[model samples]
Target: MSEQLAIHGGKRSVPESFVKPWPYVTTADQQAVMEVFKSDGIIEQQRIQSEGLAKEWAEYMGVKYCIPVNSGTAALHMSLTGVGIEPGDEVIVPAFTFWASAAAVLHHNAIPVFLDIDPETYCIDSDLIEAKISERTKAIMPVHIHGMPADMDAVLEIAKKHNLKVIEDVAQAHGARYKERLCGSMGDAAGYSTQASKTLSSGCQGGLFTTNDEIVYERASLLQYFGEIIVPGQEREDQKYNAYGLGWMYRGDMFSQAFIRSQLKRLDKNNSLRIRNCNFLTEHLSQIRGLKTPYVPNECEPVYYNYVVGFKPEEIDLNVSPRTLRDKVQKAMKAEGVSMGLWQRLPVPKQEVFQNRIGYGKGCPWKCHDSIIEYKKDDYPKTVEFIDSHSYIFDVNPPNDLELMGMYVEAFQKVMGNLDRLLK
Candidate 1:
């Protein structure tokens, strides 16, 4: 273990961190691509690879149908459009998430009603969702943020009672299970991202929309194309005039489909490795004071995409800001020959795109019970408090050898040893 640590923390390697160099791309993936390349079929056409990949993904996700798109954002847009979310409609989304979650709703001319998240799980607070729903509420897009499954049971119940459509954003969670149920299987429809950073990445980008409803599935399929409902005897000329509804060119390419299909096979094994690393980190970090690891539900099995650590500034008696702490830790790690820093930059709501009146019309309709919601500095007491003290560790593709895991553990311990000094 010590020798492995030395190898990982080489002479040129900085102190605070070292990202696992070798990425996991199985041989099966390469073979899959070669098969596609050699096949005498339309490489860029949507009918060939996209449809086939969608079918296979549907089976993998245990859904009746899956619609493959160019990107996850496109999938979300299709799902919202399929559910008939139009202008003036409001969709409830968590504030502490990727901007795509809210932006997708805005794209369809629907408003996004931002909701607070549970401090522990870091998912939208299910209890607060009911109160946020109004007459204009059309859908609830709950993102399985950072691979941790949201309170789907509660979210689904509320959706049912309110007669609202539920669109599960399974972008961060591909094989995550809540009480043995897959993340994509819980809602009316779900969106999965095959972006480079995700578990089932396609190297470039791709997206999948899964659903049991045949009508919705068909609508989403048509939306991915130019909304032309493919019919018997309707050739290219006739199909142009027989447009079904508004649509976008969000079709996935043959190459991305081939790569994603190959990567999907090894997702479970990779996720298992991530879980093992997370367990080790959690066990070690739990013993330390003033730092809290993420809380995973007993019934919920997360894929462990990004391991977040919360620092209790009050407990530490440190006068330094969260940004300061983040910088110092990262610098220290770099000095120790580590190769990483904090995961995320800032919270979603804090971004200039959300604050400024750029493409997104007047302003967002997000509000909190305690304070008036302003995009700039309007006090998001909970959000601000959390972001100020929180730092994250990203565990991407873990080292193939388990010995490297021990090196990470030792490096983490070394960083924590002088935590007080680093914060100061």
Candidate 2:
């Protein structure tokens, strides 16, 4: 007989406070932040940490230039602008990703053309890129969602054929690789987030922008510092107060940059642990009927930023929608102490901002640019289905370890074994 669920006054499968917190902050991480405070002047500190992090990250990503910014959205916006995405231009983006992927397009007054993701990878469908390329399309922004690298080869090929620039959204894929090449290195420009929850954390909000083109770097640099060509650590008399072009105060703080630098050192190690834990989960959980594990491609090495699980009602002979079954399973699993949650509830195109076209007020971009593109929610069936059926397992990173993962598997087994009780 299956053990009674904790939801019904039974002992919890996972003990209270068993799962460890993320980012795995250590004594060394603490020291790195403290070092920033020891610097003499604010300007000197900012220059040292910001420039150092840029150099370190640029070298890591095998890119020529990197700019540290305040947030991932800022980095993304800079990437689009760096690649010469002008106002009224159109940029193709995946409908399944975080809204920021598309929001960055609109920040520059460009239109975001949303496309459905591949059911398998949950990333943009490279096979569908050609159909969305219009005369006004200036770029294609392929997001490496949930630490999984998108099909870069096919995306690059299409971009080359159509003469469109590629901007990679590496917000969730810090150490992920495709065909042994790093994710951010293959695109014209890329954006990465070092936000607190991400694989490579800054302990707070932060972002990195990287590209090989000098012109693109220069353009992006201007946007980071109030559109000025001001040099960090330069003499006060030499400061340039001129605004070369429109810009935002997207510069990152010294504290966050230092923390990010410290974290970057262990990114590979953390990613490896995440891979091991996720692999273990898949090995055990794949045996459970009606549960679908993530589908990794042969050419990609994912870091498992999120361990996404899909619930298939049909496989278990459940006469309920996947969403309904997913919610019930999630509730029962929570009672057993498994940490799981849904990230996106709807496709990006179905978001109210797009549905009402309330972009920048009065449908500015659509009205101002006279864009003919429509954001019908039905266009992205795969994204809708994925969102309705799946939930992510959190804290799969290091410091949590395989032991906790084993407990998670036990919890799943217990819950699934007693689905009859769960349905009641």
Candidate 3:
């Protein structure tokens, strides 16, 4: 009786090319990048633009300092160094987040102590953090996964109690907030990514590091530019060639910086659009029996970097694994022209890097430290369950409005409404 499913030669709910690509580049973005090319002092102009963006981002984030970097990974590593994360120190992180959240700790020779996430929020479970704290615990890195801000108040309380630092990984949460406070501003130092697919895209790879502590800022600044005290806008005239310590070439490029500057002007507006679109999807999708819409906490405002949906086969009396049902639904939805896919298939601790204890060559950090901590994948049951059941719906941002959102709802209805046919 239901309309035939798309995979079974039925009419597609969303027409081909109905959903547009991400980032929604504008004419102003092009002009800004072009302006950099036309400048007489290319490097000088680049530095000016890069520093200008840092200032703007720091103001927007309500933080005291911002460092522009080449990538989010670099930003996180700089933050780790800024927080005095010495070798063998353990940094507690959520197991369900992107691997970079843990990899950044390894970059500093610090062991990442993976913890389980809150099943509802998909952020680190603040209640479980204290159990993981130890004598070697240096900091707690909580990733704002999918732009949903972590429980920063609880995290800060735990950090204060344990006398530890909190480094927020705001890579997926550019404009998100927890209890009216910005995600990056609440932490000792936070890292953000301006990668092309991110909410605050730079049209390519870029990153920002923010901190309220002057000491952390100065330390991170040293690590960002090859350990030298090369002041911005000084043209390296006051630069001392002496290497204060080990550092990396983590500077942002001129073109990406210019594009980010142009993009920052619209970040809030774009985030509003994303919030609208995601809210609409949640409203409609939540009505479907087997599909679970994202759960937003009362105290947080997320930017919806990814609109995550969970498959609840048990709710629908389906005698199948959640992953099996999810795979079938995802395929059927794709046939209906819906953009949905999984982000992380495995938990962070389950990844080969951690499973094999591979840290740099020869397991140096793990071996060099000679610590007895173990990374068992089964320790994070919630993260494994979440990954097996949920997938992200992409393009839920600006340049793709309510009409596209309506089509997405229609696609979900058509595909999930006829799951019997889809499974057959």
Candidate 4:
């Protein structure tokens, strides 16, 4: 038992701090933030950088327009609102994503129909999406969950057949591409987050709304910043303060915009490094009997937002359930100085917020005019099986120092080398 337990005085494979540094800030980032303060013109003086960054992001993603907002949730709301999702509307979304994806649907007094994800890709199962579509299904919000692009080709076809709009929740994927085309560019409109942990971080909280459709683009932009719906540079001064409808102060601040632009300079490089690290770890981890690496598709180039590893219960001699085995393995790994994390514990529909019908209780959104979804346990059995027991995330980043990745491989190997602790 001592041989299998790092906590019980076995040798630790990694250093005390194995976590890759986050918000990888530099002098340029500090200077950029200072410049925002020095100018005292948050949006007015730095408008060029703000506008330039928006254009730059759109161009990089191969989209026609980009709207910079305060958060990914804001962009999502704008996407749904832009595409005319209203009260009682239903948006089909993967159950594996952040709360924001479904929260946006509820934001508009609508319902989010949760679908199971593909165990291999950890993304929305395109095949299963069609089964869940109903008359209330207004759109398909396929999240590129964990940076791997969902089956967009299949998703798009499903959307088209159902006459539904497509809104890609691209919060985790920045440079990720599906079939050589970027993730954000494929949907009718997409939302991106520059939250601190995201691949293309804005150095602070930020969001972007992108689309090729001119009308959707226009409406999205207006919805973010006070609904000042007017063509840029053509706004008459007489209507400077004219707000046509309900709009929130959702635009990203100038400081965030400036830093995001600076970070954009090395976005691709960072993603490349992350990809290398992930691939290297995958190669090494696959050798261990119980560990499973991420499944990368031939047509998809994922960004590796969260490097997830799956646990195959049957392959190993550990008698415990997959969940218990993963917990013990992760504990042993952490003792060996590796930072491991749990992926989402519950599928979206099974979350207490959804099952309890928090928003639907008043019979408002969840109990909308059209859809009343009763979320149940094990509704998405496949999704639950994959995540609840089979998977755990390694909190890694696209580190500039490649050698640190070796330590991760060693730590994982050491933990897996001793499975006796997990055996009942």
Candidate 5:
């Protein structure tokens, strides 16, 4: 085993910079899309391709229904709305997550009662949920953060006991599995992001919602299409503009649908490469002092959306703080052409938008306050510690050509060699 040298305080070379300009979209995939575009069948009728792709995705997710939408946020909003999350209702969410997770809650006029995350999975702490549950607690939205599965057993148990709904935010985890069940199929309903940076991007923006419940599926489908109710036996003259329920225009575009369908065929192949690269990095980096790789629970088959690493303050020999160490290493790696940067900042409670309500702020949800009696930063100690100590390393999508993997491996090793000096 080759050991990495500590280069705590040194400038990086231009070539050593992390190198993922854009996600890997295959030429063959593009060609297939181009062929679709050229065909009269595609140009003539867009709905056929969209419907076909939705069916294909449904099969892929092992769910009864899959509705493709414009974006992941839209999918989340629809899922929440479809399941009856109304104004003033409180949705328990993990504070340590992307803004979209909470944003979806707020969009529905419901309040987001932020909860703490499990430090290992960086997901909602299911154990802490009972303490926050109240009469007003309508749902629990658990995000599969950075591809690691949350403890679904615990989360489900709490939900069952409390009679609360479970909505899985699977934007960061496509093809991820929890206890042999696919992620999108785990909860009452789930949302998937096919954004450009996600594991299963469509070369553009799109999202998917999956559910087995017929009522939930039907309501969600109508919600995505502006709530237009097609009556069982009535033929409407102006069908395009009619609506029967409250909804929005969150339909998926034809081009994005076609592109994603092509990409879906190779998702497993791409995920396998990510797994291999992540395992390699973990095996090598674990030997470095002061560094802690992500923890994978026994039940999870994670898809490695982003490879997160933590630098414990107590473990480091350097005088610099964890934040300073992160900055220095990121700067050096950038100089070396590597794109290393922190992914998430402080928790949601600390953010100005949530805490201060600068532009359009609402006070914390009533249910949260009533349940905990007083929501305080001190309450979620582990969540705060994880945010402060962690920095994210993006796991590049598997290159269209597997040969590029060697270059990536070499670059990572070189970056590791300069770590000690970068820290200084």
Candidate 6:
């Protein structure tokens, strides 16, 4: 390794040309998509590909029912709606997750009560949830962000005590398990995303809603298709789409549906490889001072959707902002050919949609509620800290060739060890 920092003219470690995941396309995948195109029924009545995919996914997740939708956001909105969350009802969610997780609450004219996250896991702090619960509290939507399962046992116990519905936002955690129990199967209903870049990518856009409860399944099923009713015993293709009430057109596309079936065959294997790479990265990085590696509880078997590393200003003993040192490290790491950066800059409440109350004219849900809720940027101290610092997320699904991971190890070792030069 060079003594000079990469930014100060040391050689790069990893090669930019090293590709990952190699787009696992097969001849069968090509034929299936091509056939769909030639059939002249892109939006056919049956949606066989979508239905079959949904059924298979149901078994994969160990849920009795799975409803395939156009996107993860749709799955969440329908799930909450199916669970009977109405306007004025409040759902507790993490302030530090993707907007879609909280936005789904807004979609149904409900209020999303954002809570701070557990600093170690970067997930909603189960300890803080009870404080936010109220009469209007209807559900607890715990997102398994970056594929690290949230403390489901704590969340479930809290929900049971308070009579709140539990919705697992498993968009990034396709294969994650908690204490031998699968993630999506733990909550009353769980949502999944198989869009491009997800653990189970279809090279397109898609989502799934899974649940064990029969009533919840039926409700979400009808809600996705404008309240369309399906008669029992009819084949998926022969079922009548009897529309009765208001619903969103959250139907899944045929190509994406068939495309994901190919990806499912490799989802578990892909997750295993990701876990190994993550362990390798963590083992090396954990030795560095002023740097935090991803933390997984003993009970969790994470799929590693993201190997999210953290850098807290308070955790570092330096007087200057951690961002200063973080930038130096990142610049040198990039120069060393290791990609690292923040995923989302702001937590949900800090976004303009929440700050300026600019969602859907008059901020219907935020202000439309009987008791208007006030949002302060500093209310969630931990989430704000995460936004201000803790940048850079590592993709767990690396290239087909595992050698890039070796480069990743070398890159971090070189950068962190050369901090004296980096600070200069």
- For all candidates, what are the clash counts? 13, 0, 0, 0, 20, 4
lDDT of 2 by residue, 255-300 (tens): 9999999999999999998999999999999999999999999999
* Least well predicted 10-residue stretch by lDDT in candidate 5: 1-10
State the lDDT of candidate 6 residue by residue for 52-101, as single tens digits: 88789998887898888889999999889888888879999999888999
RMSD of each: 4.5, 1.0, 1.0, 2.2, 3.9, 2.5
TM for candidate 3 is 0.98
lDDT by residue for model 1 (1-424), tens:
1222233343432333345543356688788777787877554343566667877888888898788888898888888887767776888888788888878877776677777778778788898898878888889998888899999999999999999999999998999999999998988888888988888888888888888887777788678778777643334555655667777888788888888877777778888888887787788777766567889988789987777777654556767666566566656555555444565445666667666634344453332112133454452445556666666665435653345445555565566566754554
Residue 315 in model 5: lDDT? 75
RMSD from true fold, candidate 5: 3.9
Q: Residue by residue across 326-392, what tens digits does model 3's lDDT show?
A: 9999988888888889898888888888889888979868999987788886899999889999988
Question: lDDT value for candidate 1?
Answer: 0.73
Give every collision pair in model 2.
none
What is the RMSD, in Å, between candidate 4 and the native fold over all Cα?
Answer: 2.2
Candidate 1 wrong stretches, greater than 4 Å: 1-23, 44-46, 231-241, 316-323, 337-339, 343-346, 360-379, 399-401, 420-424
Evaluation by TM-score, superior candidate among 3 and 5: 3
**Candidate 4 lowest-lDDT run of ten:** 230-239
lDDT of 6 at 199: 89
Residue pairs with colliding backbones in model 6 are: 20-399, 21-399, 341-392, 342-392
* Global local distance difference test of model 2: 0.92
lDDT (Cα, tens digit) per residue for candidate 4, span 1-424: 2244566587776766656576687788788777878885554645666687889998898888888888999999999988888888889998888888999888878888888888889889888988888888899999998899989999999898889999999999999999999988888999999988788887669899998898898777778878786555443454567787777778777878888888888899888888888888888888988877888989999988878887777797656677888788777777877777686777888887787778746766755474557677777887888876655555567553457778778777767766664453
Best by lDDT: 2
Comparison by TM-score, 3 against 6, better one: 3
Instruction: Order the candidate numbers by lDDT, best to worst.
Output: 2, 3, 4, 6, 5, 1
Q: List TM-scores for all candidates, in order.
A: 0.87, 0.98, 0.98, 0.94, 0.87, 0.92
Candidate 4: where are CA atoms >4 Å away?
1-5, 40-43, 230-238, 391-393, 422-424
